[model samples]
Target: MNDKFFIQAGALLGAVAVALGAFGAHALKAMLETSGRADTFETAVKYQFYHAIGLVLIGILLQNCAVNAERYYHWSGYAFLVGVVIFSGSLYTICFTGIRAFGAIAPIGGTLMIIGWVLLLLAAGKK
Candidate 1:
């Protein structure tokens, strides 16, 4: 259940990250560079990749860890996914739209990601 979902989600996210990275580097490179937003695009890709990896890890942990805390990992996996979407997704949009206002949405995603990490930690502590 959680295992398959998280693993599949992670794989999909990883593939998307790769594609997005390439798109940014080649397709949007000129535009982003001209707009001084190449770094922003890279940052979005980086966060996506990082959290994609986290999803994979959460999947593995949820599948194995016997801490009676599958719920924590479950939610953590979801948090990571949502965080990537909100955080990286917003940044991606900002780069394309030149709307700095979207930047405000990133911190909410960051907070979700942090909560996900804390949930993972709590998962380990369960008896």
Candidate 2:
């Protein structure tokens, strides 16, 4: 909700993304390849990393935002966070569990990420 919260969340998410990426590259490499989900796993890691950075930027923007634009930043931050969790989380789940049903959820996450960017655009448009 607030700048501090988003900053903290972003930092934590970024750290986790790095850790997960390393784990996937090493420990899970054979399994992922064997399952033919290596690309999907990498995609999840990439999106997570990208959105973690976006979250940090949104947090910083919130910190410097005009009062009237604060709401947009707040919503954008939430959208980014939730989007990453859903998008990457679903991919990760599918990679590990081999449950293709989770694929359906990835679109929702992508949509949320898109909404986050749109909200960020609106916030930027504000004076």
Candidate 3:
């Protein structure tokens, strides 16, 4: 894939993270009356934003690096995207909808995050 695509995706995810964070603070404040749940949701948003920034870095690295590590970078980007959607998305849904089913998906997202991190490590280790 093109570096531009990853950059754009990263930027978009970053913007979304901010929007979701704000929404959780203002709009969902009442809905997430329990402080613990609100905190958990906020944590999810924080990690999502961090990983989004990581994606941007990977995009930049892909553009500048002499060696083409497209596969690793692509996997990292996809994992991060999926992780954010599942991890943060599930938390937001559970917080707002009070649906217990969303909880089951949270682990899947967390696993994605672990995989993303491992991919990043392997990418860095590559010669």
Report lDDT per candidate: 0.91, 0.93, 0.82
Cα lDDT tens digits, model 2, 1-127, are 5898988899999999999999999999999999999999999999998889988998888888899899999999899999999999999999999999999999999999999999999999998
The 10-residue segment with the lowest total lDDT in model 3: 64-73
Task: Give the runs in model 3 whose Cα sits over 4 Å from its true position.
Answer: 34-36, 66-68
Model 3 TM-score, all chains together: 0.89
TM-scores, all models, native as reference: 0.94, 0.98, 0.89
Residue lDDT tens for model 1, 25-113: 99889999999999999999999999999999989888777757998999899899999999999999999999999999999898898
How many steric overlaps are in each model, in order?
0, 0, 0
Off by over 4 Å in 1: none
Q: Which prediction has the highest TM-score against the true structure? A: 2
- Clashing pairs in model 1? none
lDDT of 3 by residue, 17-100 (tens): 899889988987876666458877887889889888988887887786536466787788789888888998898788777787
Candidate with top lDDT is 2
Please say which candidate is ahead in lDDT: 1 or 2: 2
- Candidate 2, 32: how far from true, in Å? 0.4
